[model samples]
Target chain A: EAGVVQSPRYKIIEKKQPVAFWCNPISGHNTLYWYRQNLGQGPELLIRYENEEAVDDSQLPKDRFSAERLKGVDSTLKIQPAELGDSAVYLCASSQETGWGRGELFFGEGSRLTVL
Target chain B: GESVGLHLPTLSVQEGDNSIINCAYSNSASDYFIWYKQESGKGPQFIIDIRSNMDKRQGQRVTVLLNKTVKHLSLQIAATQPGDSAVYFCAETKSSNTGKLIFGQGTTLQVKP
Candidate 1:
């Protein structure tokens, strides 16, 4: 069984440009999450999806960041007019279910974005 | 807002010696805790996990000790090896059924061979 997969392992863009990252979670997983990790910092939750519904997005910057999981299996995170501070690794994770605290998430290698 | 934090930013230990990493959490309601290992240019990998009810849990060569009273957590690596060198993180969650994990700053472990 393959783990979570993400596209464009690395991305580089100039400030004010648009950038997008894609993620494909593990099979049979019903919960997916998007997180941003900066240098010397842990990954912080940006958004969370239960199936196709986004249940948690309080931490997401709606002004420039948007995410969607149309079919519930794959997800895409987009940042329009990316800023220099937006440079970081975007990680995707998935779990079997949303059952309390028992769900163990499987994460992907993450997509590193560099905005100049 | 509750947060998780590591006591040290880095630790250096001999390959054959024992190593310990410490973390402190602000949320007393957190019932679940986990430890993760991350290497350069890769994702975090699960190492071990322990519940609030248990004080200690041991894996192959790693042990996780949880002190609910002080809201502290620690990971102990026995007979540490060079391969164990990586950034270790401790995460906590208050939602028993949700998968939301609040991770600590992380501790860089450098095993000297």
Candidate 2:
């Protein structure tokens, strides 16, 4: 089986430019997550979707960051007018809904964004 | 907000020696914990996991020890090899069923050949 797949492994843009990242989860996975990892830091949750419904997005910056998982299969994370602080790695992960919150997550290689 | 933290930023060990990485979590309600290994330019790979009810769980050459009493966790690698060089992270999830994981600042493991 193939792992989670992400597009445009690396992205470079100027500050205030718009950028988008795409993710395709593994087959049969009902839960998808988007996380941002700064240098020397662990990946932080930005948003979570459970079968097309966003269950958690408290950590997402709504003013500039937006995400959607249409059809409950693929997801897209967008950053409008990206800021210099947005230069980091964007990771997408997925897990099967086991009801016990013990599901193991599988992640993609991630999209590294560099904002000048 | 409560967060997970690592005791050390880096660790160096001989190829044939053992390596241990430590992590401290502040959330006492966390019920599940996982350890991940990440190489350069790659996503984190699951190494091992342990539940709050268990104190220790062992894999092929990796062991995860959880100390709920102290809110601490540790990963031990036996007969470490150069291929084991990577950043190790410990993550915790609460019982809320959200499946949101809080990860620690990772520890870089460097094994000398």
Candidate 3:
């Protein structure tokens, strides 16, 4: 089966500009996640979706970041007025909803963003 | 804020040697842990996983040991190969359902061939 797929494997933007990333989860997967990995840091959770409803987005920078998972099959993450510090690799992952504890998570080749 | 971090930033090992990677987590509520391997420009790929209920789980040439008491986790790779070179990360989930994982800082493994 095809793994999770993401668009624009890389992106470059000036500080204060806006950018968006897209993700398509594996077929039949019910859970989707968005994570940001800064240089030398772990991937931090930005949001999570179970179907079309966002179950966890507290970590997302609401002031400038927003996400959507319409139809529960795909997701999009956006950042406006991007900061230099915001430059990082954004990863999209998916898993079957049977429960993350049992099944493994699959990730896409992340979208690397560079802010100039 | 809870976090997961690796003890080493990098690990160098001989091609035939075993490699062990360690991680420390702060969330006591976390009940599941996973180890992932990521090549440069690629995303993290699952290597192995263990639940809080079990202390050790083994998979194809890899083993994951979880210590809920100390909030420590370890991944051991047997007979490491050059292809094993990558950044390794340990991730934890507080619950079994959300599937939202909190990843570690990651350890770069360099297999000396």
Give the candidate number with the greatest lDDT: 2
Q: What's the alpha carbon RMSD for model 1?
A: 3.3
Please provide, for model 2 over B3-111, each residue's C-alpha lDDT reduced to its tens digit, 9 standing for 90 to 100. 1254778898888998889999879998989999999999888898888889999999999999998899999999999999999999998645736889999999998
Clash pairs, candidate 1, are A99-B97, A100-B96, A100-B97, A100-B98, A101-B96, A101-B97
Q: Give per-residue lDDT, candidate 1, residue B43.
A: 87
Write down the worst ten-residue block by lDDT for model 3 chain B. B1-10
Ranking by lDDT: 2, 1, 3
Best by DockQ: 1
Give, for candidate 2 chain B, the lowest lDDT window spanning 10 residues. B1-10
In angstroms and one decimal each, the interface RMSD of every candidate reads 1.7, 1.9, 2.2
Give per-residue CA lDDT, model 3, range A1-116, as digits (tens). Answer: 89999988999999999999999999999889999999888889898888999988989999999999999999999999899989999999998863644647788999999999
Residue B74 of model 1 has an lDDT of 92
Report the C-alpha lDDT of model 3 over B16-100, residue by residue, as the tens digit.
Answer: 8998888998789888888989998888888887878899999998988888888999888999999999999998885555376
Inter-residue clash pairs, candidate 2: none
Off by over 4 Å in 2: B1-6, B95-98
Which is the winner by TM-score between candidate 2 and candidate 3?
Answer: 2
DockQ of each: 0.62, 0.57, 0.61
TM-score of predicted chain B, candidate 1: 0.92
DockQ order, best first, reads: 1, 3, 2
Candidate 2 local lDDT, A46-106, one digit each (tens): 9999999999999999999999999999999999989999999999999987357664778
